[model samples]
Target: MAAAASPDRAHRLLVVAMDFDFYRQAHSDLTYADIDPAGHYGAAGWREGRDPAPWFSTDAYLEQNPDVAQAGVNPFVHYLRSGYREGRAISRSQFADAYYAALANGDVPITAAERSAAAEHFDARFYQTMNPDLAKVGIDPLDHFLRHGWREGRDPSFEFSVADYLELNPDVSASGVHPFVHYVMTGRHERRPLKLDLTFRQAALGRLQSFEGRLADARRWARPIELTQLGVLAEALANAPARGLHLTFSHDDYSRSVGGSQLCVQREAAEFARLGVNHLHVFPANGWPTVRSGATRTPMGVLLNGETVGSFVPHDITRALKSYHAEGPRSFAIHQMLGHSSRDVVDIVRAAGMNAGYFWLHDMGSLCAGVHLMRNDVESCGAPPPQSAACGVCIYGAARSGQLREHELLFSRLDLTVIAPSQVALDTWREGSDFGAREALVLPHATLVPSDEPPPMRDGPLRIAFPGTPSIHKGWPVFNHLANRFAADPRYEFFHLASKPATGTTARHHHVAVTVDQPLAMRQAMIDLSIDVALVWSLWLETFCFVAYEAAAAGAAVVTSPESGNVAAFAADSGHGLVLRDEQALEALFESGEILQLSRSVRRPGLFDLKFSRLAAELAPA
Candidate 1:
C-alpha cells in the first residue's frame, strides 16, 4: 500500500504546501467551518478530488506521478514527501498552478486575482532554460521558483530581469515579493521601467538631456533670486578709491562657508589686507553659475573686506567697473568659478583691466565640471582626455568638454598663474588641460610637523576611522566596504568621525563637529577615542586633505590608497602612515593582523604653518 505514508511526515509536508485560504475558499462548505484545512484535506477533501492549493491539482499530480495513484494515496502528500526529492515532473497544468500556489502561500503577498494574473505571464519553457539546475533535476520549475529561485536572483521568464528588477526596486526586494510576479502584476501598471541596461549612446544622451533639463530649470528662476540689488553693488564699487584692488572670484561666500578653499581665500585676503590691498570677492548668488537664457538675469554677490558689498547681475557689475575707468592697478584671484560663467569672469577681468590673474586649483572644476575628476560621483577617472569613452559615460563629460573650451579661451585672453596645493594635483591638471598658463606652481595648504612623543599603545582591537562627511569622492564607499568586511571580526572596530552620523554603513559614529572656530575638534576626539588608524582613502586627487593632518595630530597612523592624492603623498613624506596599492591589499593588511603594527608607529602631528608664503608674494605690494 505504498508503505502507508507516515502521519507526521505527511502532516508537515501538507502544512507547508497547502494554502489554507485557497482550500477554504475553493471548498465553500469548509469556508464557514472551524476545522483545520490540512485535517479536512487529509480526511475527505482529497477523496472528493479537491486540490490542496491553487497551484497543486490532485488529478494533474496523479497523472504525472502515477505511482501515487497506483498506491491509492494522496498525490500532494506523496509528491511533497518524496516526488519533489525524486525529481518528478508535472508537465501539464502544473507550471501555472505552481506559480499561483506559490503566491497563495502568503510569501509573495499578492492578491488572489493578481496571483491568477501572474501565472498567465509565466513561460514554463523559458523558466526551465533560465534555471537549468531545476530543469536538470526534472522538478517542476515554477514550484521551485515560487519557493526559492527568486531569492537566488533567478528569473522566471524573458519578460523580466530578476537582478535588475530587484536592484531597481529595492522596496519590492525589501518587501520579499518575487520580482517577476511584482513586475507582471503591479510594476507594469505603475509604469515602472524594464530593461535598465542602456547602450553607451543612449546613456550618454540621457545624461546630457538631464543636465540640459537642470540648466533650463535654473534659467527659469525670477530676475531677483536674492533680496539684494544692482544699485547696492554699483554704489560699493563707485565708493572704491581704485588703489590696485585684489578681486577674488569664488563659487560661494567664503566668510560663512567652512572648507579648505574658503579658508585659503580668507587667508589670502588677510595677506592682501596686510599688504594694504583692497580684496573684493565676487561669486554667483544662485550657487552654480550658468549661461543666462537670453534675457534671464542671474545675480552675483559681492563682498569687500568681509562685508557684503551688494548683489548685481554680472553684466551690470562689469559695466559699472568699466564706466569708472578709475583703475589704479588690479590683480585678479579666481579662488573658484564653479557656479560663475567663465565669460562673466573674463568680462570682469577685462573691464577691471587685471594685469595678472591667479587661478587656484581648489578643485578640478577648471578641468571638468565633475570636480575632483570623480566620474559620475562614484570613483575617480584620473582626468582622462576630453571626449574619451570614460568621459562619454560620465554625466559631466559634455559639460567638462565645454568648460575646458571656455577655460582655454579664458587662459588665452588673460595671463593666468595656475597654483595647485600639491605637485600631483598640478601634474594631473596639466596632463588633462592645455590652458597655456603664464606660470604653474605648488603652494601647500598646510605642512606637517612631527611631535616628540609617540602614540600610546592600547590593548584592544584596532580602531580604524573615516573622518569628515561620508561623501563618495572622499572615499566613503571604500571605508564602508572595509567596515562591512571586518564587522564581525574581533580584531577591528570601524568608526565615522564627523559632525553628523551616516546611514547604511557598519561604522560606530562619533560626532566630531569641526568648524572654523573649532578646527581641532576632530583631532581632539580622535585622541580621546584613541583612534588607531585613519582611513583617508579619497578617490580623487585631493589638492590637500585636512583629515590626514587631523589624524596625524591625534597620533593615529593613516591607512590610505595610492590614488588619495595629497593624503598618500603626506603619508609617505611624513612617515605618519602607510599607502596601500588597492582595496585588496587593504583587506589583506586587516586580515594579516599587521594593522596593529601600523598603530605602533603613530607619531604626534604639529602644525607647520607655512602661512601662504607664495600666495603673499603673488599679491604684489600695493
Candidate 2:
C-alpha cells in the first residue's frame, strides 16, 4: 500500500501543487466567478477530472494509479505524498517544460517580452474564430495565446500556424517555447519556412472528396461476395447460356457507383442476357486486389445478371480457372484492369477458351496506373512517353512502363479489338503507343437529339455550375478558385450540383443525385436552377464526360478546358458550348462579357440512348 498523508498535510500539498491561472482557465466557471480554485478542488473539481496544474493531470494520474483512485484519496495529495517519490509514469503534459517549471516554483506572471512578441504575431479574431470556446470567455485573446493557445496547438494568425511551425522546426518544439513567440523573435530571422505547401495535400484531399460518392454507393448497395457459391456460379453460367458465355472484367462493382463506364457495363450485360448469352461481370473484390495472409492468392467478385453471385479466392489459380471454363464458344470484354492482375486476365481468357476480346479505352488505365493520366493526381500528363522525364516525376511514373508492358502482353496473347467511346479518345490513345490492336474504332455512348428550346432570357448575373462531384481531375479546384475570385462580384453566381456539398468552397450547393433510375436528375436540376453555364474544366483528357451531355440537355452552355478530351470535342462539334484554351482565356471571356453573349447563342444538347449491343454481333467471333 502507498504511504498516506494526514488531512492537514494533504491540504498543504494540494495548495502547493495547484496552479491558479491554469485551474481557472481549464474551468472557466471558476475564474472571475470569485470561487477559489483550491476550495473548488476540495469540493468537486478533483472528482470532475479537472487537472490541478499544467504539469499534473488529475484523471491521468488516477488512471495510471488505479489504487489511488480506489482509495478515494485526492490524487494530487497521493502524488505529493509518495507517488512522485515512486517515479510513477503520468500522462505526458501537453504544455511545454517552461509552463511546468514556472508552475513548480510559484505563480509566474506572463513576461512583458513574451506578451509583446505574441501580440506582434497574433490575430485576436483569428485565434478566437479558430477556437470558439476561447471566444466565449471574456479573457484577452493575446493573453490566452501567451499563456495557453500555443500549448493547445492553435494558430496565432492566418500566416503562422503553431502546428506547422512545430512540425517544420523540431528545435523550437524541443525547447518548450511558445511557437508564435519563437517565430516573431528568431524563426523569421533564421529564414525558416512558414506555411506548408498544400498543393500535394489538396491533390490528395480532392481524390478522397471525389471518392466519397462512390463510397456512399458501396456502403448502400455493394454486398460481400458469397464465398461458398463460387462453384455454383461457374456451373450456372456454363449451363444457362443458349449461345455462349460473355465475360466482362472491370475495376469495381458496377452496382456500387454511377459512372459512365459502369453504366455502359450494365447496359452491355442486360443486352447480352436478352440475346440468350450468360453474362458474368468479374472485378477485384472491394475495388482493390486483396492478398490473403500466409498465401499469394487474391479474391475476386463475380456478378451474373447484375447480381454478385460469388467471391473466388484461388489458392491454386490454374485449378480455379478450369472451374470457370465453359465448352461453348466464349467472347470477352476487358473494360478496365485497375485492381486486377494483367497476367491473370490473360490466363482467364486462355482458360475459358475465348476466341475474341474487346478492350475499352476507359480513361487510359492501360497506358498508366493513374487512370486519368494525372501526374501526381494534379494536372494531366497527356499520356507522355513512359520513359520521359515527366513520367519519372509523376507518382504513377514508376508503374507506367511496367503497366504498358503488361497491357501489351495481354493484347498480344488475345485476339484483341480496341473500342473508344469517341474518335478523339481513339486518336489520343493511338498517338500514345502502338498496342497491336487487331482493330480500333469509335463508338459513341449516345447519339444526341438537339433540343428546340429558344435561347434562355435572364436578368440577373449568369448562374454558373460544375456538374458532378468535386474532384481534382474533374477541375473542381479550378472552378472553386474562380468562384472565390468572383465571390463578391455580381457578374456570376457559383453553384455545385452533386449529391453532397464540397467543403471550404464558395459555391451554393444543390443536391442532385444521378443514378441508373434517376439519370435525368442533373439535367432537371440545371433547368430548375436556370443555370446558364456548366463549367466542365476537366484537368485530364476525359474519354467521354456525361456532365457535358447533361449540361447541354438542360440548355446550359458548356464551358470547358481544351484538356477535356471528348467534352472539348462535343462542344466544338455540337456547337452547344465554348471550349476555352485555359483559365486565363476563360477569365477573359467573363471579363469581356463574351460568356453572356455565348450563353444567348447556346445550342440545345441532344439526348441519345446508350446501346453497346449495336456492335455486339460484330465484336463476337464467327
Candidate 3:
C-alpha cells in the first residue's frame, strides 16, 4: 500500500519496461529471427555469441508488475489519498438509492416525480465505471450516460425535472442537509489542502500578527492637539501647569540649518515630549521627522484621487508617516496656509484627524510682479508698498494664474497666525494685507557669533574683502569696476573670495585677487590676513545678509549699499559697519582717514558684543 501511494514507485517500474519492449519489438521486425540458439538472429548480427534473449526477457519482466494492471491507481490518486482516508466503495447507484429513500421518508422532502427522475439519473453512473478517464478530466460520465449511453430518444439539452435533482441527492430537502446547496449558492469550488512547509507557514503567520500589533498600538496613541514649532511646543508642554500647548514650527525660512540646527530641533522636540508637548507640526517637504512630538504619527488626510492625485501616492505618505510617528511624538502641527499645494498637505493632515495651523512665509502681494513698484520692469528696495496691497498682487496672481491655488487655498482655509523672521517682515505684512498688522509677530532670524579673540592688525595695504559668490545682482559688476579703477593705484588692494576664477576681461585687473572656492580655508585666511574692510555691494533688497554678519563678527569694518535691506539696521545698531549709497560717499570715507578709524573701531566690544547677545536671545525660547 505504501509503495502504491508513491508516484515515484510507479514511475520506476513502468517506465523501465515500456522503453525496453518498444525497442525490442522494432529490432525483431527488421530481421528474420524465428529461433536462434545463440540468441542473435538479426540483419545487423546473426553471430552465435551475440544475443537478443536478454532484451526479450527484460521486456517480459516489465509486463509482470501488478501495479500496472491496476489502471485507476496513479500518482493523482495518491495525491488525493494524502488528504482523504480510504473507505468502502460508495457505488453511484447505491448513493442515489439512499438519496431517493431519504427524500421519500420526509428526511429529504421532495415530490414523488422528482424521486423517480433522480433514480434514472443514478443508473447512469455504471457508464463512468466502464470509462474512468472521462471522470479523471472532470467530465460527468453519469450525465453523458443519461443523455446518450443507450440513445433512448432523449435530447441532451432537455431541462432536468425537479424530480431528477431530488432523486439524485436523497437529502436535498432534508433539515440535516449536506453542504452541496450552500456551496452552490456561494459559488465556491472545492480547493485542495495547502502544503506549505512548516518554517514558511510560521513566518507568514508572524508577519500578519506583527502588522495587527502595530495598528493596535497606533490607535492607542492618537492625540487631540496640534502645535508646530518644536521648541515652542516643548516649552509649552514643559510649562503646562494648566493645559498642554499644541505647538508647531510652520515657517520654512526659520527652519533652516545652522551649525547644529537639525540636532537642536530633534533634541528640543524630544525634550518637549518629555515635558508633555503633545502636538508637533511636521513638514515632510523639509525632511523633518514626522512624529517627533508624540509616540504616534498621523497622516495629513487629503482626498487625493483621479488627476488631482499626483506623484504623492498614498503608500509613500503612509510609509513616511509610519516612520515618523514611530519616533514617538506626542502630537502634530500641520502648516503653510497660503498656497494650493499647502492646502493639499493640510487636507491630508486633517484627514488623519490631526490639528492644523496656517503659516505665512512672505508677503505674497508686494512680492508679486503686478503690484510691485517696478523700475524698468524690476522692483528695487526704494520704498515699501501700502498695507492693503502688500500681499494682494501675489495672492491674486497666484489664484488667477492657477500657479499655486493649493497653497493659496491653504492660506484661505486654515485658522492661521503670521510669524515673521524679522521686524521688517512683520511690518511689510501689516502694510500689505487685511490679515491685520497685529496678526504678525517679529520672530527674528537666529544667529551664532563665533568667540575668537580679535587678532592684532598687520601692516599692509588694506585688504577690502568681498566674501560671497560674485553674481551680477550681488554687485559683482560694482566690485569689478572698483577693482579695475583701484588697480591703477597701488595704495589699496582688492580680493575676490569665490569658488572659481573671475570670468571675462575683469580677470586682467591686478588688484582682483581670487582665492578660488575654499569656504573654510578662505574664512580662516581672512582672519589671518587681518582684513580691514569687508565690502557688501548688493543691488537687490536682501532680507538678511549672512556674509555681512560673519564679516562683522570677524571684526572687519563693513561697507555695504544702503539698499541692502537689513544691512542698514545692522550698521545702525552695531556701529561695527558702515552703509554707503553712492561711490562718491565711499570715496570720501576712503580718502578722509575715516576708513582707518572705522577699521580700528570694528573690534570694540560694544559693537561686536551686542551682536552676540542679540543672536543668543533670538535663539532662546520665547
Candidate 4:
C-alpha cells in the first residue's frame, strides 16, 4: 500500500492491503466500496491508475520521523503509499510536465514506472539520488540499462541483471535490497514495459514549448537553416538527444563582433572548432565599401612632372580644388531606397557558350536581348543568389548593367569565369576586385589592320588633331588648356575633332579649330581631316585604346598616356609616336622641332582584322 491518501484513505488503504476482510470487519454493517465510497482502494486511488492526496497533512508523520523530512524526501512517498486511492484521470502530456518539474524540484521513490521515467528524464545527480536500490547492488544505472536493456517488456534475464553481474563479481556486491520491489520495478520476470515512452507524435506535441514563431526583424532570422537566439540554442544543446538542431552565429552580415561573440575572426574560429556548425562563410555585404559622395582623400600636394606645384585645403567646390575620388555618372541608391527590385539577367556564356570578352560581363549584367532589355526572374542561378540584372552602368545600360555589376562583380558568385580584352583591362579588373582568385583570364579582342590607303597631303605647320567627346576621361581639360596656351602662336595649329559638334565656347575659341566630322566612313574622315599629330590622350584604361590605333592608322603621330594599357604598350613596341607622362610634357612637344618632324613622318599603317578566335579559345576548356 502506497502513501497516496489523507488520514482516512491512508488508513482504509492500509487495512485493505493488509486484509481486504479487515476493512469489511471494521465496517461489518457495510461493504468495502461503501466504507470507502470514492473507490480509492479499488480502481480509483492506485499506482496503476489515478490516486488521491492524503486526506490530512503529513505533519504528524513528519513529527514522528524528523529524518525523513530532513532528507528532503517526500513524506507521502516514504510514510504512506501509492495504489491506495483514486482521483481524476491522468494523461502523459499532463504528467510529463509535472514529472520533469518534480524531478527538477527533488527526488522521490514513488513507483517503478516513475523511477524508470526519472532515470531516463533527469540528470546524473538526480538519478544517483533516486536509484539507491540499483547502486547498492553495485550496478551502474546508466551502463546497466544501456547494456542489459531497461525493463521495456520482455523476459528479464537474471544472468545479465545488475544483481547477477554483482554476484559474478561478488567482491562488488552485498545484496540486502528488496527482491520483490526490484521485480516490480524491473517488471514481471524480465517482461519489460514497451510502451512507457511516448510515440514521436506524442512526444513532439507533448514537448516543452520552444522559442520559435516569436517573430523578430528581417536581419534577426534571415538564415533558413540555423537558429539565431543563444538562450534557445543553449537549451537545445542541454537536451541533445531530444532535439536534432544545434545553434550557430555564421552569417556573413556580421564581420566584426556581434555582442561579445567575435565574427570573421580567429576567436570564433577556435570556438566553432568544437561546435556542431559546418558553415560560416563571409558575404560581400558584410564588408561593403563605404560609398560616399566626396573623395576619400584631398590633394596633399599638387605636382607636375614630379615637381611640387601647390597644396591647400578646400574651402569650397572650385576648379582649383578637385575631388580625388572618381564620380559615377549617377546614383544607384534610388532603387534600394524606393524598394524597386532589380530585373533579372541571363548569363551570356552559360546560355550561348561564348567566351567572355571586353564588356561581356558588363553585357551579361544586363538583360539586353538584341534590342530590348531582358528581365531577371532571379531564380535560375543558385547562390549565393544572383542580384537583379537592373544594376549596371547607367551611362550605358542603367539598371541592366549596374545591377549585373553588383551581382557579378561586386558580390558575385565563384562560378563565373570573367574575361578581359587586354593587359590594361586585366590590370584594372585585378585592382578593383576581391575576386580573380578563382576564374580570371587574359585575352584581347584585337585585329591586324594593314596600312594601305595613304592620306592626301595637307598644307600646315604641324597639323595636330585631338578627337573625342568633351569628356573628363578624354583629357578634355588638358586639351582646352593647350588650346588656350597656343592660341596666339601662328607656328602651331590644332583641330579638335569631336564625335559630335561642340556648341558652347568651342565655336568661338581662339586657338584650336573645332569641327563635327561625323563621317559615314573612316577612310573618308581620315582623308577629309588631313591632320598630322593625333592626340589620343585619355585617363581611363581604354581597353585597347582603338582611338589611338585608328588615329595612328590614319597616318597621325599619336601622343598618348604611357599607362593607358595596350595603346601605350603597342606604341612602345611599334615606335609609333610619343608616350608621355603628363600634359605639361605635351606642351613642350607642341613647341619643339620633334613635333614638326613626327608630323611629316606619321603614316597610315592600317591594322584592322576581326579577331573572333580569341572568343573561341576563351570558350574552350583548359
Candidate 5:
C-alpha cells in the first residue's frame, strides 16, 4: 500500500543507519564507515519492532517528497525528500540529530545511551506531573519512578543490579525504605483488611514463634504427665523379664554423665511388649537400686551438659517412665551385688509379695570384694568412684568396708537367681562367684537406640564420638588423652556426649549434648552431625554397654576395647568394629582409616529378645 524501493535504494538506507550510529557515538573518533550497517534492522529500515505490513511505507510522501517518492525510491520516501533532496547531500551530524529526535518520539531500537538520556528527561516530567510526594521529600524530581518510567524494560545483561543502582543514586535510596516496601507501608500498593496492617502481621508472627517455643519446651521435658495411664505401669512391674531386662542405674534417665539406661529400658521394653511376639520387662523398674520408697539417697537433680533440668525422688523416674508408655515393670532384677541388701531391699520387693527375685551381673562382685576389679588387675579391693560408694563399698566390699563374711550370713535367707548376657560375663562370674548365673543368654537387655535418620556421608576430618557419661570409671581419662593427643591435627574431631553441660573447653574437641530429655532429638542430631566412630573405652567391665549399642544404632562405627564385659565381646562379634587394646592404639587406628569402612558395616545386635525368652523359659517350672 506504500511506495516500493529498488535494491540500490535499500543499500543506501543501510549506509544511512551507519551514519545514525556514528552520530550516536557523540560523533567522537568514529566515522560513518566504522559502524556495522546491519546493526539497525527490520523488514525495511524504520526500527526492529516496527510493523512490516507497510513494506517500505511512510506518511504521504507526495506531500513531503514529491520527486523522490514519485520516483518510487521506496523506504522512508518522505524523509529522503525532506532531508536529502535529489541534488542535496546529507551529513552524519544531520542524521544523528534526526535519530535522536525519533528516540524522543517513543520509537524503539534507539542506541542504549541515547535511550537512557531521553528516559531521564521523560521520567522527571512524569513524576512531577503524577506524584504528590515530589514536594515533601525534596528529592530530585526524576528520582520517583515506582518500578518504571519511559524505559519500562531492559536487557538484564546490560542493566545494573538494584544494589548498583542504589550505589549510583544514594540520594534516592536515602529518601525512605525500599521503594516496593514503602509503597505497601504507605498503603499505596493495595487496599487491605485490618489483619494485613503492620501491627497485626507482627502480632501473628509473634504468636507463631511462641507456639514453636512451647513445642520445643514440651519436647525437652522428660517427665511424664497425665497422657498415659498408671495401669500400664502396674502391669510392667508385676511381670518384668516378662520379656527384656536392664538394671537400676546410679542416676535417672536424665543423667548423660552415666547413660540413658532407664530411658533405654522403658522404651525398648515397651516396644517388645507391644510387639507381643517375644516377652519383655525392664529390670527393677528400668533404673538402678530397684528404687523402693527410700532405697536410694536423696533424689538428686539430673544435670546434663551442666544444666539442672529436673529432680526425682526414689522410683519416681521409673514411675514416670511407666506412666509415659502406659506400661510397667513385670519383675525386678538386681544388677551387681554392689548396691543391694537382703532386708530393706528384698523386703521392699517381697512386701509386694513378689518372690521372683532375679539377680543380674557383668562382674562377680558377690565372689570378689570389688565389682570393678579388672581381670588380673587387683591385689586387694579397689576404691569406688567418689561419687558413688555402692560399688561393693557399702554392702559387699570384699576386703575394705563391708565384710563378705557378714554379707554371706545375710544372703543365705533370700531367694535370688543371677543372670548374665555373654560368655565373658558368665566366665568372669564363675571365676569369682560361688553361685553362677542361672541363665547365660548372650543378649544385652537394652535394645539399641531406635534408628531414625540415615548416616550422613562424610569425606573430611575423622569425627569421633564417646557415647557415655564422661565419668572417670566409664573412661573420661581416655577421652581426655585422645583430646590432648590430637590437639594439633586438623584431620581429627572429637565429641563427648557429656551429661554435664560444657564447663570449659579444650581446643582439641567439642562436647555434644546428648540428653535423656530428648532421645529422638539426640538420635537425629547424631545422624545429622555425621558422628563417625564411638569409643568403648571404659575402665570397668560394663554389665552391658548400652552406650556402645546406642552409638551403633545412631550410625557410628563402634571402636570398643578388647577388654572385659559385653562391650569387647560384642565389638569383636560384630566384625564391623575396631577393637583397639588401649589408648596407645587410638592414633594408629585413626591413621588406619579402617573406621570409614567399619562405619558402613554396622549391624544391630539382637537386643533383649533372646535373653528375655531364655529367662522366661528358665523362670517356668519343668
Candidate 6:
C-alpha cells in the first residue's frame, strides 16, 4: 500500500477498504491503507485477490505507499448475503466499487446492500448483546435490526413498519414496542430526556423544572427527546446526551422569587458552585437593574429642564436590584437595557462579585425610546410636544431623554458586550449612541423556528389575529373599528387574545380571548389557527413584542403600528410585513391587496434562531 497526499492540503490520508485491497494497493502513494474483507471471502478471497494484485507487481506503488494492514472482517458482505436469501440479489461488486471510490474521494456512501447488512447485523447484535429480551418478542431480526439502526442509530427516512417487524418478533410487548417501534417506524427517538440536578433551589428549580414536564409531554406526542437535566439527572437523560449541561434562568421568570423579601433558596447557584460548573445564565425579568451606589432613593422624580417631570425608577427597579445580589451568578444579563444599564449594572454586579456581562435588548431604551414618540396622533420625535401634559404621553419619556448619553457612558464602563433583538435596534443604537457602538451585536428575539415540515397553510374566511391583553394602550379600539368595518365582508374572521366581542352585539370581530395564564396553549392555538396576519396595534412603547415573533414564526405576516418601537424593526427587515402608521395605511393596504402580498411573504426565519445563536456567540466564554 502507498501513502497519498490529500488533494487540497497534501496532508496524509487514511483509507480503509474491505476485500478490495488491490484497488488501494494500486494507489500505494496514498497516506495510509487498511484493507480486509470478512464473511464468505475468508482467507481464500484475500489469497486469490492478492496473488496477482496490481500493487504486488508494481514495486513503485508499494514503495511509495505507507504500511498497509488488514483490519476487521467485512460485515458489509455478510449483510448482502442476508438480503440475498430473501431473493434480493443486489450486486455486491457494484456497491463495493462505488463505495470504494466515494471513500477515496473523501465521501461516505450508504448503499442499499450496506444499509441492509448493517441493519441486520445491528438486530442480531442488539439481541445477542445489548437487549436479548428484544429477541423473545417474535420480532423479525431483520426488522428489529432496521428499527434499531434507524432510531438509536441514524440511517435516514422516518418511514418504517412496526407491525411488519412485530410479526417476526411476536414476544415483544406493545408497551416496549412503542418507543423502539417509533424509532424504527418514524426514524425518531421515542423521548428526548433532559437532565436536571435535583439539588437546585426551589426558585431556580421551579423555572428549569417547568421545562422538564413540558418537554416530557412533548416527547409523548413527537418522536424527539426534548428536555433533559444535567448532573443529578444525568442517568435519566442518558438516552439523549447531546444536549449538554448548564441550566437557564431568565431574569423575568426568577426575578420575583430572588428579589422579593422571602429570599428563596439559591439552589442553582449552590449547585453550580458545588459542581464547579461555570456556565450560568442571568436573564433578567422586565429590564436590567441600574444601581446608584452611595445613594438610595425611592421613586425619584425625573426632570428634563429643571421641571419636576415623571419618575425615573419604578417599583420593579428595587426588585431587580435585589435579585442581582441574591443569585450572584457567573454571567449576568441586562434584559431590557440599551447600553446605559449594561454599564451601570456591570459596575454594580462586578463590585458584588459577578465578572461576566451579557445584555439582551428586550426594548428601545438601549436604542431610542423616542421610537414611541408621537405627534398629531402620528409617530414623530423632536417635533415639539403637543402640550406639557402631552410630554408625559410618551410611554418611555424618562428613559428616552438622555439615552445616547447614558449608552455612551455605559459602553466604556462595561468589560463585555451588549446585544439587540433586531438589526434595526442594533443599527439605531449604534447610530444614535456613542457607547459600545462598535461592540454592540444584533441578537433578534426568540421565536419558534419553523420546522422543515411546517403545518399546512389554512385558507378560509380571512382569519385576522390580534394577540395581546386588552388594554386601551394596545389600540383595542382601533382593532375593534377595523373588525367592525370588515365584519360584513363575509370573508373576514377575527381572533383576539385577552379580548372579547363587544357586549350585546354579534359583531363581525370574533374575540378569541386568550390570556397570559395559559401562555403555552395560547401560543400553540395561534400556530394551529395559522392566522394570516397578526395586527399589533400598540399605542404605547413596547421593548420587543414576543407576539409578533410568534406570529411570524407561524408564517403569519405582522401588521403593527409604527409607534410600537422595535416591533416596526421586525416588520422592515424580515420581509414579514409592515408597520401601519394610521388607519389610512391600513385601508390602503387592504384596498390595494398588498396585505395579501405581505402575508404570502411572511416566511422570515423566527427571531429565536437569529438571536439565540448571536447571544450565545457574544456571551460564550469569549
lDDT (Cα, tens digit) per residue for candidate 3, span 1-622: 4345444543443343222322232332322234332112222221221223222222222234344324433322232343134431211221233333433543323345543444443423333432333344434444333322222222121222223333444455344332222223321334311122233223333444332344356456544423233333223324433223333433222223322122223333444444543433333332221111211232222211100111233233433333333222233333222111444454445543444342433323223322122221122433334233532432222222232333335455555556554565555445544542224455443353556565556665666777666664466666665654454344466776654556421222122222112223434545655666777876555545656666666667778876655666676676767788765687676666466665543444322321311221222232
Give one clash count per candidate, in the order shown: 3, 2, 56, 46, 26, 52
Query: Per-residue lDDT tens digits of candidate 5, residues 528-592?
Result: 66776777776666667656665666666677665536777777786436677765686576566
RMSD of each: 17.6, 8.8, 32.7, 36.1, 25.8, 24.5
Positional deviation of 482 in candidate 5, in angstroms? 2.2
lDDT of 2 at 522: 83
Which ranking of candidates, highest lDDT first?
1, 2, 5, 6, 3, 4
Best by TM-score: 2
| Model 6 misplaced regions, further than 4 Å | 1-294, 297-329, 337-347, 354-356, 366-412, 436-438, 447-454, 457-459, 471-475, 498-523, 538-544, 561-575, 578-581, 588-618
Off by over 4 Å in 3: 1-340, 348-366, 369-408, 436-439, 447-452, 499-502, 505-525, 587-597, 601-622
Residue 164 in model 5: lDDT: 37
Task: Please write out the lDDT profile of model 4 over residues 363-423, one tens digit for every residue.
Answer: 1222221011111211112111123343231122223233334434422422435555566
TM-score of each: 0.63, 0.65, 0.41, 0.34, 0.42, 0.41
Tens-digit lDDT string for candidate 2 (425-462): 89889988788899998877665565555434556887
For model 6, what is the error of residue 368's alpha carbon versus the real structure, in angstroms, after optimal superposition?
6.9
Ten residues in a row with the worst lDDT in model 3? 301-310
**Which residue pairs show collisions in model 1?**
55-97, 288-339, 289-339
List ranges where model 2 is wrong by over 4 Å.
1-230, 235-243, 286-296, 314-329, 452-458, 591-593, 600-622
In model 1, how many backbone clashes occur? 3
